[model samples]
Target: MIPPAFRDPVHDSQSAFRRLLKALSRPGTPVSLTGPAQPPAPMGGPLAAIALTLADADCPIWLDPALSTEPVRRYLHFHTNAPQIADPKAAAIALIGDAGRLPGLNEFHPGEAAYPDRSTTLILQLPALTGGPSVRLSGPGIETTASLAPRGLPGWFWQAWHENAARYPLGVDIFLTDDRIVIGLPRSTKVEAP
Candidate 1:
């Protein structure tokens, strides 16, 4: 059921779509959006806008264990006509809670040599965004170290990302959303510890 606040997606879609598009267009940047995003049972909170902006018939999604319930999956399938996949490599979108449990940086398809655009996008249900020990992201789209409070970019990820960077035009792009805001990890952004 659409939330009471979002009875009108036709209108809401415009703003939500703009925020998502802008976030994707600029790497190492953050965007804030709010409104009728009442996610379904067990799927918890961020489900609403996530369903609205990311799902579609052409994209395949891989749900984390926390989001693997039948009701949640069914709701997404019914609404978006998006297929669900078991392998992250096959998914165009991967929904997860802990970025830690996801397959090592090498396992998922980080796009290909030529068609680097064919990479997976990961959406995480973050516990919170904080300041300590965080990294600063900056590059082409970022004006400065886009001081990001990303919680779980595991140690190995930094190492592997260096490898992905080696692939240059071929690497995965990341979009992270918390309860209040969403941020980007564009393939072009560089990460350094704060």
Candidate 2:
């Protein structure tokens, strides 16, 4: 059966949105989320909650191979009325189930200089938020610098992130999620590995 969406759609979505904003505003800091009632497989509560909170009829989503299952498709379509696009560049949001095998960050839309807000927002599902190689983050919203070690990302993830950040106001934003935690990595954040 298709799992339910938010219990109280209005309130739940509002709460989810607030948490998302908090995460993005303070990059690298983990935020808790009260996800959907019972999200489908491959998509745990945190990813499902972010999807529900951000995606809508006007936002087209791009699902990676791991999360492009029929059930996930149906659930998202039914609940959000958001269309799933095949081309990553055309999607407003990209849902990635496997961070270790993620496509090149540039494969997705990196908004043009004049319209940076049009860039894709990636929501990636990882095994855990820690236990991997740690990186230092410094940018707006951060007091000084924050350290993060999200497990399951590829070896070149940080390098790619640096490249993405170099583009200044023209790169994709990211939301990293595990079971119940989420952390944002806006393009403005600089990632340095030691």
Candidate 3:
């Protein structure tokens, strides 16, 4: 059977949305998401919560191969009414399950200078938020610097992220999630690998 989404659609979605915004505003800090029940396999609570909070009929979603299972697709479709697209660049939201084999950040749409908000928002479901080698993060929301140690990211991720951050308003924003927490990495954030 397909697992359920947020138990209380109205309240839960609203609460999740607030936490998502908090994550973004605090960049690199993990925020707790309390709403969603378990989604399908491989789709964790925080990732599912993000989809339920931000996706809608007008949103176009792209799922990486590892997360594009039939059950996951059906669950997202039934709850969000968001259409799934084959092209990552055309997606408003992209859910990535396997960070180790993630696509290059440049492959996704970096919204045009005229409308930066049109860029894709990525949700990466990682194995754990900690226990990996650390990278330094500093930018808008960060007072001085912060550390991120999300496991499973590709070796080239930090280099790619620097290039992404250099684009300013044109790059895609990302949310890193484990099972129950999410950390936002807006394009404005700077990531330095150690």
Candidate 4:
């Protein structure tokens, strides 16, 4: 049976949304998500909370093959009432369970000049949130530069991120999560290897 959603949808969702906004605003800073529901296997708590908070009937979600499981689909559908789309370009949110096998950064919609906000937002679930190769981040919302060391990402991720960042207002945004912590990486942020 599918687990129940948050005990109080209004309050819980609002709290989660605030945390997400703060994370996105201060890119690379970690935020903790609290909710009543615990997601099934392969879906971290923070990621599940994000899906419930951000996704709705208007937003369609795309799942990587590794995350396209019955329990996950059921949970998201029952809680968010969001459609599941097959094409990555059509997804408002893309969930990547295994960053090691992540699709090319360009595969998803980068949005258009006229409507840059339509680009997909990725939620990548990693094994750990710290202690890996660090990347220097600088841009809006950053004073000078911030360093982040997200573990379990593919080696080519930084290079692809550089290319994606070059797209300016047209690139997708990302939220990296483990079990409880979440860090945002908006497309506007410049990522450099350290």
Global lDDT scores for all candidate models? 0.68, 0.95, 0.92, 0.91
> Once model 4 is optimally superposed onto the true structure by TM-score, how far is the C-alpha of residue 21 displaced, in angstroms?
0.7
State how far residue 187 of model 2 sits from its true place (Å). 0.4
- 1-194, model 4: which lDDT tens digit per residue? 99877788899889999999999999999889775556877887788888888999999999999889999999999988999999999999999999889999899999999999999999999999898899999999899999999999999999999988999999999999988899999999999987
For residue 5, model 4's alpha carbon misses the true position, in angstroms, by 1.9
Cα deviation of 2, candidate 4, in Å: 0.5
Task: Show model 4 residue runs off by greater than 4 Å.
Answer: none
| Residue 68, candidate 1: alpha-carbon lDDT | 85
- What is every candidate's alpha-carbon RMSD to the true fold? 2.6, 0.7, 1.0, 1.0
Residue-level error in angstroms, candidate 4, position 157: 0.6
lDDT per residue as tens, model 3, 103-175: 9998899999999999999999999999987999999999999999989899899899999999998899999
The alpha-carbon root-mean-square deviation between model 1 and the true structure, to one decimal in Å, is: 2.6
Evaluate candidate 4 by giving its C-alpha RMSD to the native, one decimal. Answer: 1.0
- lDDT, model 4: 0.91
lDDT measured at residue 20 in model 4 versus the true structure, 0 to 100: 91
User: lDDT tens digits, residues 37-74, model 1?
Assistant: 55665443443566556778999888878788776777
Worst 10 residues of 2 by lDDT: 33-42
The superposed Cα distance between candidate 1 and the true structure at residue 42, in angstroms, equals: 4.7
